[model samples]
Target: MSIGMSFGLVFGLTLFDNIAMGLPLGMGIGIAIGASLDADAKNKGKTI
Candidate 1:
């Protein structure tokens, strides 16, 4: 899920840059989820 979100955000940003012009919505949502996961992992004492 986190990975998916990251990919989605990347894809969205890329699309916005006209590099792909794909799904921005999915990208935004994915980024949010990924960020949350990253935070969680860091809090868990995991190397992010």
Candidate 2:
């Protein structure tokens, strides 16, 4: 979330734009990626 906001600012976006656009997008993507990895780990454990 902070990463995304920083990136937006670095790229010349407004502060409001950073929060409105970056935070939710970054957090959602992060959550999806983490969920995928957790599911993969569980599957690997089951196989083993």
Candidate 3:
């Protein structure tokens, strides 16, 4: 999440010069990715 947010922040700052737009967007995308990874791990019985 942090990584995604930071990346998004940098991207937004560099391109759009916006922080509000980037932070939440990055967080949402990060959450989706985290969920997907968690589900995959659970399916394989690899989750702890």
Candidate 4:
């Protein structure tokens, strides 16, 4: 999610200084979390 990406970018900038690494890492985590949420929502018969 964009939220995660932004957070990651900020975190990376604050802690490390690697925009490239931070963006992808954050994107991956966001996608995984989003997928999990989506699956859970679908199982619960809800729309996300």
Candidate 5:
């Protein structure tokens, strides 16, 4: 959702720019967030 939103915003400003900037940025952020959630779930002994 973050990636999509970023892509949409950047694309609205300049077409294709989102692919270069937003994608990697959003993916990095998403990975970080996913990792944190995974860690938290593991701490609570829950499956994601």
Candidate 6:
């Protein structure tokens, strides 16, 4: 999933910037996604 997101981000950003900038942006997005999933996992089956 990270690889796919990275590839998509790279492809999308390639139109505006170089691969260098796209790489970090993709990584940041992937990390954000992972973190959100982790948060959801931690809260699973719990009452708020």
The number of clashing residue pairs in each candidate reads 3, 0, 0, 0, 0, 0
How many steric overlaps does candidate 6 have? 0
* Regions more than 4 Å wrong, model 3: none
lDDT of each: 0.68, 0.59, 0.82, 0.86, 0.66, 0.69
Give the Å error, residue 44, model 6. 0.4
Comparing 1 and 3 on lDDT, the stronger one: 3
Q: Kindly give the stretch of ten consecutive residues in candidate 2 with the minimal lDDT sum.
A: 10-19
Worst 10 residues of 1 by lDDT: 17-26
Q: Which stretches of candidate 5 lie over 4 Å from their true place?
A: 1-18
Q: What is the per-residue lDDT of model 3 for residues 22-47, given as tens digits with 9 covering 90 to 100?
A: 88878877788888889999999995
List model 4 lDDT by residue over 1-48, tens digit each: 887798779877877888987898788878888999999999999988
Q: TM-score for each prediction? A: 0.53, 0.56, 0.78, 0.77, 0.60, 0.65
**Tens-digit per-residue lDDT, 1-48, candidate 1:** 555555666776776754244455566676788889899999999998
Top candidate, metric TM-score: 3
Query: What is the model-wide C-alpha lDDT for candidate 5?
Result: 0.66
* Over 4 Å off, model 2: 1-17, 46-48
Clashes of 5: 0
- How does candidate 3 fare on TM-score? 0.78
Q: Which candidate order results from sorting by TM-score in descending order?
A: 3, 4, 6, 5, 2, 1
The best candidate by lDDT is 4
lDDT of 6 by residue, 1-48 (tens): 486467757765776567766666677777887777778877895433
